[model samples]
Target: MKITVILCYAMFLGACLSFLGGCASGKSSASRVEVTPFSCVLAPDTNGSVCVDVVFRVPSQYLSRRSRLIIVPQLLLDGKLSEELTPLVVDAPIYAKKMYRRKVVQNYQDPYDAYTGKVEGVSGGLELPYRETLTIPLGVHTGCVQAIVTEDGCGGCTGLDTVEVASVRNLASLIQDTFELVRMEPTFHEGKVEVLLQFLINRHEIRSDLGNNRSQLKKLAGSLRPILADTLTRVGDFRIYGMASADGSRAFNTTLARKRAESLREWLLKELDIHPELYTRMVVDSRPEGWLPVYQAMVDDGHPDSLFVGQILRRYPGSDDDVQEQYIRRLSCWKDICSRYLQKDRKIECAYTYTSYESVLATDGMWIPFPIKQMEANNQAILCLRRGQFEKAVDLLKDFVHYTPATMNTLAVGHFRKGDVKSAEKLLRKVKLPEAFRNLGVLMALQGKWYEAYRFLKGSGSLNEAVVALILSYNEEAEAIMAELSDQSPLAEYVRALVTSRLGDDVAFEVHLKNACQLDELRLRAAGEPDFEKYREDKIFREIVK
Candidate 1:
């Protein structure tokens, strides 16, 4: 009986030792917890939450009486961890020496007690297959969900076991500027042809003594051929204001003026082979004796008689037809006046408006040629600029001089588009053109000079200016400017949508956003814009951006 008691005690002792050893060696740290492949999904629930499900497997031996499982979850966006979600705590079975003999867990409390304490569970040979569903708000940018599990068991603990839950994405820009229309107008050339014809005294007939007079008439008539051939021409009256010399009687001189003008018109028509009907409408009028020419000639001759001539003209001022000439012919300067000036008084002056066409072939696009050859380079550069060849445009304009305000403005724009804002601003200071103001405003807005940008952009009526206003939170200004945009460009409307969204005008926002997406034709760009962040959870916003 004594021997049997001793053997039974030893057996009990040995069994207790074996049980304690098993608990101490509880599945090596590597096999403690195993999580299956899981990932965060982009499926947004009706509650504006993104759902992610994960499965964890805890081996039977890993659940010791003193051990607990703590899971810390975090969302990583663009490789950065999110701090919004709370960590999860799940306690496991603790197999104490006395509790092992009972074969049942005691004091099993829910791990979510919100306190730091140990919980108990049944000490069974069954493995734990756990599944959990985590809901994260859709507002968070979650590229991946990470789960870090650590066992709070024996004196020493297992290092962190990390599981990555990658998120799935199932969802799917004009630098707008104002352009002026190019217009081409026909070129016009204007000139006058004057003819001085001589006639025999008191006679309306042409004289042989006249030198080169016929040749002069022929030259004048021939010049009209080229003018008449122009696409557009306006022929003025062929005027012949005839005058008489001071020696002739008033009545005879008048008759001679009229007859001489008529004879000259007839001769021109016959000699030039022009229609007589056209000459009939020509102007032929008689004027008083041409005394002004005689006075002017005496003054121009610088003769000693000029002082006496001026005194005589000023002393005797009469409106009579030949009074002045009558007195002048009696003076010593009379010969100088008649010989130099009276001969020039008998003349015909002809003038007409002529418009010609010049064809300028553009390289491509809607570029027009510059009016002057010096600016041809600028024209070509503008063409290149319109085609988005900024570097080529810059190269073409590199050596260009004679910069007009328009050319400077275009070159500045090219430089701005190339990210050379300093150079662009330098050129802009030379001109206060509206385009220059708008470009400067755009640059200022990019540099975060909001107030300065507003100052420059105000009243510009440019779509880019409106965009800057919207970005700077100048709602009233943005709305006012955007309303004036006739093109309703996608970028402009998109900015309007942002303004409306801020004002809580959902209907208008939706309307504008829809139009923007339609015109722009790409939803992804809208998705990346920060202005729409608040609407990320809205179904309409999602649909449009997607």
Candidate 2:
């Protein structure tokens, strides 16, 4: 009974083989299929898509005598199928004959038999070669190419089987990461304050009770207090000018004016405690008041002789103060003018110029005045930029003429962060600073110009530079940069994780990713990051993301 069963089994196997058009002597092996460009990378192209060159080789006798081989190429993103290329089909003699009979003689069509290229009459030793360039839309961060092979037996004698023939991994994609924010250096600003003190006629000394002298000196001192209180401020150009009324002789008035200026200068030196060096730098001058002030005061007061005084002054424009004063004394309202406005010009005026070194507080995304006080226009615009107020910053900077290289860089950065790439590039082109180059690199990266970004970010020594390096597959350089980076923030840790993963350091990648996932934002980013797709099912990665 056992011998009969064995004989029956042998006959059935032989019949099956014969019905399948006779199996080849050589065994079918997936190793016979070859794919070129072992490391599949979807690089960005100028045509708005990522394209790759693909070549497939099937050695002789790779297909069975009565079988059909269908090869489909697919692009996988994050381990999920993204795009599929046209299939390449090859059929043995019997299978090709059957397909031809079904389609032509029986007038039947099979939708499942769709293919781009086909090879019929394999003859048990035919070799097949397929080569083509495949394309897909850009912006995929990570992806790989895989070739799937499907085998269909002749007349159902053998069951269908599918297998992965070839694949390439470590596809690169654009990285979105934090950029550098440059801090502005301290700037120099100048301010001036003046105080006018009226003096009694012909008098050289100051009378505190006269006119508004006491109040004016007090106000001037108050203004000086704040300027002196700040160590960053330096006061200089201490100048005192004395002008006498037109009532006295030119010689007498000039001497009186000089004495009046000296008296005020001495008072300031004593009261303000002016340093000896500053005192030496002080300037004192004297002048006799011409008839202009008298004429102006009369016209303003609507005096009857105002026009006459103006006529005389204009007629003798080149005359000295004495000649002009003599002509002005003849006016009918001269006395009135002396009482009202002449006394105004008979005064000692003190003026000083100061320079202040100003700085601001700069954070990641916001800037504040260092002392929490009102800032100048330029500094205010910087604050606006750091706060993401792009329009306001542009408005403030557009018409401003005194832009430093640093301020120009700030303006460019504002435009870049606001999605105005053209404007940002135009402005950055004019700025010659390392910060500007760094910003340009980031802009290039954002626009899918990885090579340009790599060039611009080279030697920047910033995390942004390292990220660009990683995206360009400069693994060793990226690793070296990460080691040099001093940033310990979650974003920095996340970038470190990316670098380690690309370098095949799985343990370090997990550690860095865990550290970065502490932040909810980073965790969410990692959850969808294609670079971390392989780790999505990892126990520790799942826990970290969850």
What lDDT does each candidate get?
A: 0.60, 0.67
What is the alpha-carbon lDDT of model 2 when measured against the actual structure? 0.67
Model 2: pairs clashing at backbone N, Cα or C within 3 Å: none
For all predicted structures, in order, the TM-scores are 0.38, 0.53
Off by over 4 Å in 1: 1-371, 388-392, 400-402, 417-419, 519-522, 525-546
Report the C-alpha lDDT of model 1 over 46-102, residue by residue, as the tens digit: 233455555555556555656555666676654566553555565554523433444
Count of clashes, each model: 4, 0
By TM-score, the best candidate is 2
Best model number under lDDT: 2
State how far residue 4 of model 1 sits from its true place (Å): 44
Model 2 vs truth, CA RMSD:
20.1
For 1-546, candidate 2 gives per-residue lDDT tens digits of 999999999999987875465433323465356655444444543333544555655556556656777777776664688778767777766677777899998898766576623566454344445555655455343356677766575444433333343332222333443444455434444554555767655567877787787887888677766765676677766677877657668788888888888887788778777677877888988866666766777788888778888788888886777887777777777777667766553556666777665643332223443422233455777778768788887776666444555666777777776778798888777766787788788777767787898898899878777877876789899899989989888878988998888778999998899999888767765775656768879888888888
